[model samples]
Target: MKITSVIARQLLDTKTRPLVEVEIRTDTGHVGLGAAPTGSSVGVHEAFVLRDGNPAEYDGLSVHHAVASVTDHIAPALVGAELDLRVLDQKMIDLDGTSDKSKLGSNAIYSTSIALLRASAAAAGVPTYTYVADLMGLPPVSTVPVPSFNMINGGRYGDLTQPFNEFLVMPYKAESIEQAVEKSVKVFKVLDQLLTEKIGHKPQVASSYGYAAPSADPREVLQILAEAVDRAGCSDIMAFALDCASSEMYDKTAHTYELNGRRVSSAELIDYTRQLSEEFPLVFVEDLLDEDDWDGYTQAVAEIPKTIILGDDLIVTNRERLERAVELSAVDGFILKPNQVGTISEALDCYSYGQDRGLLAIPSGRSGGVIDDVVMDLSVGLGVPFQKNGAPRSGERIEKLNFLLRVADSVPHCSMADVSALVKA
Candidate 1:
C-alpha cells in the first residue's frame, strides 16, 4: 500500500485544553488514527510531519523533531516503496543502526509510531492488540475488574480557575455496585467537610474547566476520607483501592503546592495518607513527589503501611525510567497513560513490565478529553485488571464510565459489580 495523505485536526476539549487527532491515509484505503499535541501555543504543529500535497509539513516538528525526521526522511522511502505493513518494523539495527525510540519526543514519537502500527494492522486484517500480541508472542489477554476513582470527595487546592485536577485516592474493589456508590458518596461528603474545616467552604466543581478546586492539604483531606470510609454503609468497602495522586507535594520546588490557597509540601502532606493507610488501608498512591525525587518516594512508600506507591509522571511510561524506579524501590504501581508515553504499544509494554514485577497496573484517562474510548479498550485488551477513570460526573469522566458500564453488561461474571476486587490485587 502506498502512503497517500496525512491529515490532522485540533479539537478544543475545554477553554484551556485541546487534543490533536491525526489520520494517515493509504492508497489502499486504510487509514490509521492517532492523537498528538493540540493548540497553537503548544507543540501541536511540531507533532506531525506530513508529506502529501501540503507545504506546512514542518510547522510543529520542533515538538517531535525526530519523528518529523522519520516521516520526512524515512517514511517517504517506504511509502510508495512497497513493504508489508505487517511484520514491518524499523528497528535500530534494521535502519542501518539509525532510528532510536529514545531520540523521539515522548508524545510525538508515540503518536507517530502507533499511527504507523494501526495503519499496518488495518492493512493486515487484524486488531491492533492482536497484531501487537502476535509480534510479542504473548498469550491472549485476561479480563480484569475496572477501577473507579473518587476524587470528587477531596478538599480543594490550587487556583479555582486552573483547569488542572487530581484524583485523591483509588478504591479498587467493592463487593457490590451499590456498596461502591455508597462509598463514593461518603468520600464526597468527607471531602466537603475537610474543605469546610480548612478553607471555610464547600469545594466548587468548575464547569468551564472541569476540575475541582481547593487542592487542599493531603493529610487532613485523607483523614476525612478515612473517616468517611469508616462511617460509610458498606462493610465490604475495605476491598476497594485508595488513590494518592497527591503524594508529590513534598519537594521544596513543588512543595507547598497550592490547595484552596494553602501551600503544602510533601512532608506536611503524606502523614495523613500514612495514617489513613494504617487505619483503613489502601491500594495505591500515585505521583508522591516531583519526578526527580526518587529517594523521597522510596522512603515514603516504605514508611506508608501496606499500600502501593505508584508513579505516573514520575515513571512517564518509559521502560528505562520505570526500570530505574524499580531498582530504586521507588514504586509498587504504575499509572499508565498512552498520550503521556504517546502510543498504545509503548503503554502496553510498560504495563506488562509492571505486571511481571508484581506491580499493580492502573490504566488512566486524561482528565481533559472525550476521545478516551480507545484508552478504555486498550486497558481491557491488555488485561490490566484495573482501570482509573474520573468521577461518576463530568463529561470526560462520564465518557469513560459509560464505556466501562457497557463492557460490564457484555461480560456477566467479569463485570465491575464490585470495586473491592481491584483493591485486593
Candidate 2:
C-alpha cells in the first residue's frame, strides 16, 4: 500500500503539555494515528522535542514548530512513498540528517514513525504486535510483559521531597495480564484508602497518575506500599521497583547527590540503594545514578548484584550508548522509550542490541504521554520481560494497561511474561 496523505497537529498530553500528533492515511483506507510523549525528567542525550519559544503560548512549551516540521517537511517527502515502516523511517532520518533529529524534531519524527508502523500493520491485515514481530524477524509469541504499576510519585513528578521519582509494584506472580492488573489495581485502591486516612483527605495524583508520596523518607513510602500490599492480600505476588531519576538530584559541582535532605557521594548513594534493596523485595532500581556517571553506575551494578540495575537516562534508548553500557557492564537492563530515540526502528534496534548482550528490556511510557497504546503492542511483540506505564489510573495510563488485557484475551495460549528470574533471592 502507498501512503496517500499525512496530517499533523498540536495536541495536549496528559499533563496538559503541548505535543505533536500525526496521522497517516494509506491508499488501502487504513488510518494510523500516533503522538509523541514528553518526559518530565528527560535525559540530556535524548532526542530534542521542538517547541516554539514564544512564551505567550503554553509558556514556550507549544509544539507548533514540531507540527510545522511534520506538515511542511515530513509529509511532503513521505506522502507518495511506500508504506514500509523501515523505508519511510530511513527516509525521514536521511532528510533530517542530524544525529539528534533536531532538524525536523524528534516529536514530529517519532509521531510519524509510529503512525507509519500502525498504518503498515493495518494494511497487512494483522494485529500491530504480529506485524512488529515480523518486522523484528521474531516468531509470534503469546507472552504479555509484566506490568510495573507506579504507585508512588516523588522527585520532579510530585511535590514530595523524596529524591526517588517513582515507587512501583509489579505483580509478577500473576498467571495472566488480567490477573496482574487486578492485583495491582487492588493494591492501588488499598493504598488510596490508606493514604486518605493518613493524610486526612484525598491524596494528590502526580503527573504519572501515581499518588503523591505523603512523606519525604523513601523508606516510609515503601512501608506504606508494603502495608497496602498486605491489606490487598498481594504480598506474595508483588515485587517492587524504583526509578530514582538520580540525575534530577545530582549535584554536579559537589560531585554528590542531594538525597533525602542530605548530600551523599556516589559510593554513599550506592550503599543507600543496596540497603533499600535489602529492606524491600526490589526487583530493579532504575537510573539509580546520574546519566553521565558511568563509573558510578558500574559501581552500583557491581555492588547490587542481586537486584536489577536498570538504566533509562543512562542509555536514552540509543544503540551507541547501550553498547558503551555493555562495555562497562553498567546495568542489567534499560528502559526503552521510543521518542527518546526519535523512531520505533531505532528503539527496536537498541532493544535488539541489548537483548543480544543478555540485558532485559522494559518498554515504558512517558509521564506526558497521549492515549496511544502502541507501547503495549511493542512489549508483547518483543516478548519483553516487563513494561512500565504508570499506575492503572487515568485515561492514558489505563489505555496501555487495557491494551494488555485485550491482548491477553485475543492471543491464544497467552501468558504473563515470567518474572521469577527477576525476583531477588
Candidate 3:
C-alpha cells in the first residue's frame, strides 16, 4: 500500500489550546488519524512548535502556521511516498532542515508521523501495538506497563501553592493492567474523600485532573497521600513518585532553586529530596534538579541510590542528551514523550538506546493532551516498565486507561510488567 493523500487541521486539546491534527489516507482505503499534545511545562531544548503570532487569535497560541506547514510543505512531499514510517519521517525532517524542527513545527511533523504509523498498521491488518513492536525489531510480547497514576497536582499545572508538579501512585504489585487501574481508582476515591473532608467541600482539581492539594509543603502532601493509600488498603502494593519539575523554580542568575518560598543551592535541594525519600515510599523522583545541573543529578543518583532518579526536562527524549546523561550517571530512567522529539521513530530510537544501557523508560502524557491514546499502545508494545497518565478522571485521561483495560482483556496471557526491583524500601 502507498500513501494517497495527507491533510491537516487545527483542533483544541483538553485545555482548549490549539493543536495540529493530521490525517493520512492510503491507496487501500485505510485512514489514520494523529495529533500532537502540548505541554504546560515544556523543556527548553525540546522541538519547537510553530504558532501564529496574531494577538487576536487564541491569545496568540493558534497553530495556523503548523497547519500551513503540513498542507504546503509536508503533504506535497508525502502524498506519493511509500507507506514506510521511517522513510516518511526522514523526508519531513530533511524538508524542515533544522535541528529543532523550527521550519516545519514539531507539532506538524509529529502528527503526520503518527498518522503514517496508524495508516501503515491498518494497511498491514494488525493491531497498532503489534505493528509498533515489529518496527522496533522486537519479537511478540504481551507485557503491559505498570501505570503511574498522578494523584495530586502542584506547581505550574495546579492551582496550589506547592512547588512540586505531580504526586503519583504506582500500583506495581498488580498482576494485570486491569488490577492496577482498579487499585489506582480506589486510592483516588479515598484521596478525594479525605481532601473533601479536610477542605469542607469537594476539592478543586488541577489541570491534569489530580486534586489540587491544600498545602504547599511537599512532606505534608505525601503524608496525606500515604493516609489515603492506607485507607484504601493499598499501602502494601502502592509506591509514590514525584515530578518536581524543578527547572521551573530555578533562578539562573542566582544559581539557586526557590522551593516553598526559600532559595536553596543544589546541595540543599538534593538533601531536601533525600529527606522526602527517607520519609515516604518514593520510588521515583523526576527532574529534581535543573535541566543543566548534570553535577547535581550525579549527586542525587549517588545520595538517593534506592529511588529512581528519572529525567524529563533534563533529557527531552533526545538521544544525545540521553547519551551524555548515561556517561555522567545523571539518571536511572528517562520519560518518553514522542512530541518532544517530533517523530515516533526518533522517540523509539531514544527508548532503545536507554534500554540498551539498562535504564527504565516511562512513556508519559502531557498536561495539555488530546483524546489520542497512541501512547498506551507504545508503552505496551515496547514492554516498558512504567507508563504515566494522569489520574483516572476526564475523557482524555480515561481514554488511555480504557485502552489499557481493553488490551488486557483482548490479549491472551498478557501480564503487567514486574517493577518490584525498582521500588525503594
Candidate 3: tens digits of C-alpha lDDT, residues 134-232: 888887868778888899988643454688889999988876788789989999999999999888999888877899877888888999999999999
Give each model a TM-score: 0.70, 0.96, 0.97
- Candidate 1 C-alpha lDDT tens digits along 359-409: 776766665445544566566556566667656566666666655555555
Question: What is the overall TM-score of model 2 with all chains considered together?
Answer: 0.96
Q: Is candidate 1 or candidate 3 better by TM-score?
A: 3
- Tell me the spans in candidate 1 whose CA falls farther than 4 Å from its real position: 1-4, 14-16, 37-78, 81-107, 120-144, 153-171, 175-202, 206-215, 223-235, 238-272, 411-413, 416-425
Q: Kindly list the per-residue Cα lDDT of model 2 for residues 1-425, writing each as its tens digit.
A: 78999999998988899988899998889988988888888899999889999999999999998899999999999998878888889999998999999999999999999999998888889988899999899989778888899999886434547789899999988877888999899999999999999999998887667899888788899999999999999998898999999998898999999777789999999998888888898989999999999999999989987699999999999999999999999999999998899999999999999999899889998888777657877998898888897988889888888888888888888888887976773
lDDT of each: 0.53, 0.89, 0.89
Best by TM-score: 3
Full candidate order by TM-score, most accurate first: 3, 2, 1
List residue ranges in candidate 2 displaced over 4 A.
156-160
Clashing pairs in 3: none
The reply for model 3, stretches above 4 Å from the true place, is: 156-160
Candidate 3 shows a clash count of: 0
